[model samples]
Target chain A: MTKLLEANNLGKRFGQQTAVSDINIHLSRGEVLGFLGPNGAGKSTTMKMLSGNLAPTNGQILINGVDLLEQPKQAKAHIGYLPETPPLYRELTVREFLVFCGRLNLLAGKPLRIAVDRVIERCGLGDVQHRLIGQLSKGFQQRVGIAQAIVHHPAVVILDEPTSGLDPIQIRDIRHLIREVANEHSVILSTHILPEVQMLCDRVQIIAHGQLLFSDSIDALSKQMHASSLQVQLANAPSVSELSAIAGVVSVQTIADSTFRLHYQPDNDPTERLVSLAVANGWQLRQLVAEQHSLEDVFMKIVQREENSKDA
Target chain B: MLNLARNELYRLFLSPLAWVILALSQALLAYLFLSHLDYFMQIQSQIAAIPGAPGVTEMIVAPLLGNAAIVLLLISPLITMRLLAEERRNESLPLLTSAPLTAAGVVMGKFLGSFAFLLILLFMVLLMPLSLLLGSHIDLMQLASGALGLLLLIASFMAIGLFLSSLTRQPAIAAVATFSLLFFLWIVDWAGQSGHDDAGWLGWLSLLKHFEPMLQGELYTADVAYYLIVTLTFLLFAIRKLDNERLTG
Candidate 1:
């Protein structure tokens, strides 16, 4: 549970426009932290700063307790970054590029070759190891990109839109590969794909409009925005005020004539109490159930709240 | 650093563009000699006709090498235009910049790779002097000096090209800028001399003039220093530009 990376008050600006502002993020070892954001939301910018490709306009980045700007070589030693496009050379064969990458990471002799072989095998690039990179499919090329990034055996692997421009099967395969890799290295994957974060990432940080809205585990995020709801289907229509007056019932909304919904406070399981009250009132509770919160619902609610705040 | 340069050199060797430029330049240099063979033979015959006359090779050898240096200048921008420019265009500079290698290493490695290819082109043309001319007065030291001068000259311009390539992602733009800057330096030296007494030291800017004396057998420290400084300046410029890009972009 040690902190692997930290950025304090990190910011970036292009002339008059600020790409990122007042952002602070920290990651721990073996944590697959998903960076969820829309296009132009500064996900890529923040990642570039962390990976040593772009410097922050202001603030500090520490990798394994080392200041990035002060000791860049050491700071970058623990990071394996695959930019949005993978930064691959189209000319070199897969093995050659990886060998060069291993050397760039200062690996040589046995360890270098071992590292290259491990990553190439791990990335499933063994089939095309001798093929020119430009000749590979988009998925294969991305795999090579991932291979080169992790060839140095860094502590953290940062991928920007790793699943972008991929078919569903390829996306699933890559996501599975990411999960496998996450067992060893802390993963920071920047993606707008909701399912990618939900399925592969352990925690998610939602960024929008150059500001971080929230960062938490998927379960915690759902609990925050998803108010517990009591889904009751009555044989006949129930008065809104009647349902609202029920104990543990904070409010009532009508989804349909016979189906009424109840929003209640957190930690209060109102389904039993509501059923008791319905029995007392002789209301026909044909369907009485507890609603489960989904990640999609949570994401939409959080996004809506931000939009509301912007309007306010 | 070596790995990066090795990768760059591999790409240079594999690129069809490099071979196209090589073959094309070889033909041009050979033809430059072939078309003027009669004129050069006439001068050699004149020197031969006179007893104990200075050999034509001694007088025109440096100029011919300088002419080949000019060929280097012309074809180099084409070779170097893609070094950093295309990398930036394809968003590959970050791959190199983010690695453990420093900015200086990247620029120097690329410059050396481009210079290596230029040296190959110059070496390929050595047969021209060997097969065509029957002179027994070939000074091995002078030939080495001429090749060294051409290498130094090519290195200086390659540095300039490397710096210019870092300036833009558009290969055409970088190539044009390199040509314009080198062309200005080529004519600027003569123009500086034509300006009479007022324009002092402006003539030193010309790479041609500094390399001129070294084109002959004798090595001048000043010329070596001049080329080295220009090489160092442009290389430092490229490194600084790369560092700035990393910091701000």
Candidate 2:
């Protein structure tokens, strides 16, 4: 896995306000890295710095081992960026716009034509190739935006909120196209959609309040989503101390006269022992289920924990 | 840079704005050209009676070219207003900024794109003077000098428009600002004429003052240098503005 892009200690300031700071990120070939953040969390700012659209106030960015600040032209040749607004010339047709984008990335002659055609086919823009971009539907226009970003076959494709304003079906189609694009090129997508990161990204970086709070593989994030507690309803429930005495139960909370919530470690289980004790002691167990945590819960917990640590 | 210029021309021609401007200007200038020619013909014998009177080139072609300059000045902002301001407003400037291009490349590409269109308009206006060659002998050198003057003048107009365009995100605002600046430079010579000797600097700064010499069949390097300096200065300003945007945006 060769690293196709790298940014170290990236920071940006707008006059007296800081937009982003101490941000480090990298992407390897054939991998999709999701940038997860809330709105105004500086996701777009970081994307602008990485794509060479805005110069970072401090830090260094290397695309394909070339320093962006020292050799921007050479380094930016490997970057294809789709800004939040799509950066399109609405007067030109889809095909014409893509060809122009291809030429801007230094493609020409047969190669430029071939690259434009390949992107149009890949992005499902064949039908609207000759139609004016402004005349097309929003979905088709977004597809044109994506097509132009990939037309030059750059090594790194940086998309800022690619599915931000699309309908559900259009989002599905765009997601499918992104999945296909990830097979050949490295992709760094900034989005606030949790399910989108879960579905498409190999790794996720969670950013909030202009700082990165978490970075890990998606598997690790899901591991945090595993069941960590149980809700139980029992006739003639045992004492809170008695439930706490169970081998795997970490703590006990009384929910009601006949119901209790049991906390336990993910790898440890107390369900079997509690059930046997209920049968022997004649304590009737009515309902018992593992409480599952949603990804939203995990995300919020991580963000909240960071805020708490800062407050301390 | 050439590729970007081609794209600019492609977009310009694709819209109805450029075609409409071209057609309207050509028709209005052609009407002015023929009417002036008509007036010149009626006074041809009276002018021939006077010794060393102005020729057909001075009476017809020079004023036609002068009118062309004013016509282009009114319309050049329309062509250049969208060059950068509209792109920034639409948020499409990131496309060029993110590409492997320098600020100079983008500025020059836009400059040349609109410059090419204005040059075409200049050529069409020159055709009206060239048409007089069939019946009467015209001063080719004066016509050439006047054409050169108009070329430099419009180039400076475009540079001014381009620089102003880069300063804002609204096309209408860019157009109005460019017109105000160019119009001020055009009329600044009036201040010098009305005032004392100290107002010579105002006359020197007037765009029309340098342009007047070339329109009168007088070609001076100093006049040419003034236009060149104005054009280059504004172009540098535009390029610097774009580079600063990348840094501060």
Please report the candidate that would top TM-score against the real structure. Answer: 2
| Top candidate when judged by DockQ against the true structure | 2
lDDT for B184 (candidate 1): 83
- The deviation in Å at residue A171 for candidate 2 is 0.6
**After TM-score superposition, what is the CA distance of residue B78 in candidate 1 from its true location, in Å?**
0.7
The deviation in Å at residue A201 for candidate 1 is 1.5
Q: After superposition, how far is residue A249 of candidate 1 from its true place, in Å?
A: 9.9
Q: Judge candidate 1 against the unseen true structure and give its global Cα lDDT, from 0 to 1.
A: 0.84
> On residues A1-312, what C-alpha lDDT tens digit does candidate 2 reach at each position?
788999999999999899999999989888899998889999999999999988999999999999999999999899889898888889888888998899999999999989988999999988889988989887788788888788888899999999999999999999999999998889999999878999999999988878888899988877766767899999988788988999999999989998999999767888899999989987899999888676567768887887799899
Looking at model 1, residue B50 earns an lDDT score of 83
Q: Once superposed on the true structure, which residue ranges of model 2 sit more than 4 Å away at CA?
A: A227-296, A304-312
Q: In candidate 1, what are the lDDT values of residues A1-312, reduced to their tens digit?
A: 688899999999998999999888899998999998888899999999999989899999998898988899888888899999888889889999999888988999999989999998898988899999999999898898888888999988899999999998988888888998898889999998776787887788988878888888977765664558878898865689988876777888888888988988767667777777778888878997677655456556777888899899
Which residue pairs collide, candidate 1? none
As for candidate 2, its clashing pairs are: none
